[model samples]
Target: MIESSHTSPSAGWAARRLAELHLAAVFLTRLPLPHLRPPLPALSAALWAFPLVGAGIGLAGGAVLMLASAVGLPGPLAAGLALLATVLLTGALHEDGLADIADGFGGGATRARKLEILRDSRVGSYGVVALLLVVGLRWQALASLAANPLSAALVLTAAHALARASVPWAMVLGRPARSDGLGAAAGEASLVIALITLAVGMVVAVGLVPALALPMAGLMLTITAGIGWVATRQIGGYTGDVLGAIVLLSETAALMAATR
Candidate 1:
């Protein structure tokens, strides 16, 4: 006694999956989503697309660099501008997370105190130092890589994607640090999703930059595990801000592998 539309089950599933992708894109980027009104379930399901969003952002940043170079800008200048574009696109989401994690871990004496520090809106000394190191090192690395636009684009694309994949990777390995907040709200991700995320990231990264694949993957995985360990020890679990720190540090490690 049910009225059915023309949509098949497989087609409906595909449509829902595509909606999750759109949700991920909207959440991760500054881009507008006029038609899509994804629910909280969609958001939770979209974690796998986090790296895909990074790929889009990285490619856009790389394109900006290419355009700048074509216009006669110096490699350093173009690199800085590309970094600026990425910051703008993501609204410095990960950057802010990095700052908070630094302030929390560096300044807090106890776990509760650390969590309290992280929730503050204002940046602290630890946060400032962390931001400077991350931004400065990223700028320098991008500048050096910018000498070869093709290589720069490939590595940036791969690094961003792989770095983002580390978030769910951490979530899979650690529990939420708090009872409530963004980290908890993300819910629990499964190991299968984590593995798929890592696999996709690995394939894309190695496919693009075959020469530095082994070293880059080795460094990225080591750094990712190291950050996860530090977060687990310091806070007893992972937080949203910790996930952000993981992305920035993981990307930096990968980019460093490509540096000459």
Candidate 2:
């Protein structure tokens, strides 16, 4: 009963649209649609899927850690595997963002200067420190929660989904710092998708940690808004790096909250 864009309602248009959307989601996330070629519209959908992608990555990481534990892997080794899985799954995209943001915010004397710093590929002292702290915090949090594999998995899934959701909100609430690049592509629908993802993430979190989900969601939202404001003020908008930093920080915050 669906129609194609080129045809009437009987042409399977809705099905095709859904297919395009799925392609976009796979491209943006880790859904493993290996056969489809990446197209612009699909890429657009993928952008919305970024948070879901993170959630998938988190789920995989947790599952790996759980499996290792079941098979009697050492606790440290299992935790390390989970961490490594996350890194590999995301290709450390957000980690790089966090570092860039740190360098830009720490080393620049003015807002314009900060934005310039973020564009630079060279890492700085602030970047190094920030990366170290983030990695350390994540490791500690995961290790502490290792005893409860299911809880850890839930935390990872929730964190990733929440982190990605921040990107759309940032795109909606803030301006794009540059005329071109990834940030500019984020539009109103993307922001809506991000909000919906956030709501779903919160629901999942509540199921895992009933006493803490509400407060955690509030904290995540507050931090996301603060970061967006800072980025907007500094660069007149956001860039891919800013979005990445938001994801990293939000995820870390969620992890910490769940542990508490």
Candidate 3:
């Protein structure tokens, strides 16, 4: 068999891309991978693989759901356990972001106040309420979908992948809120990376559930964009907390749309 002109180079690129994916997975989730201790620049470059990391998280959640269900748990309980698995997997990273952003936006009267609120370690009333609402909605939506393990797993996978895919777009559309933080440190992902994430998300959505694909995509995009807009207007730009909030909210929106 004759090798194509592009074959060797493409193969090499794929191999390197796998490293980026591992970095992204490590950064985004608590899952153990061989530690490479790549520099910040390499981690920033790995942003392209964030969605794939999300997909892995979703699969882990689904596996939890399946195990719970097989052990005689009800859908609601299984769904809750599955959601819990994801929370643990990601160290509730985005959940914490959602709470901080909520508290900051709700309590702050000025941009400075908002940023300060975001920095505080304590959770306020706004943060508590936001977590309740988000977590409750997710549990309910997952329960509704979890009646069939296969369907629920597929939806979870698609929801997670698509939700993360929105982050690069959000990053590209909004500037960092400050001189330092994960948001600024991430720099600006290229349009190519953004589009690739979007494309991968679309494929996951359509492949998982053709009927809900358009609606899920629309919901995810709208929610993510709205988040970006709100973050920019409130804080002058995005921060690490803002990006985390975007991912969690987008995932919830996608799951709700998929279930409906």
Best by lDDT: 3
lDDT of each: 0.84, 0.74, 0.86
lDDT of 1 by residue, 66-163 (tens): 88888989999999999899989998888888999899999999999999988998999999999999899988998999888878988888888888
lDDT of 2: 0.74
Clashes of each: 0, 6, 0
For candidate 2, the TM-score is: 0.83
**What tens digits encode model 3's per-residue C-alpha lDDT throughout 179-231?**
98788888678888888888877877788777877777787778778988999
**Backbone clashes in model 2, listed as residue pairs:** 2-12, 3-12, 3-13, 4-13, 175-237, 177-238
Flag regions of model 1 displaced more than 4 Å: 1-6, 38-42
Q: How many clashing residue pairs, candidate 3? A: 0
Best-fitting candidate, measured by TM-score?
A: 1
User: Stretches of candidate 2 above 4 Å error?
Assistant: 1-32, 35-39, 42-48, 188-191, 203-212
lDDT of 2 at 200: 63
State every prediction's TM-score relative to the real structure.
0.94, 0.83, 0.92
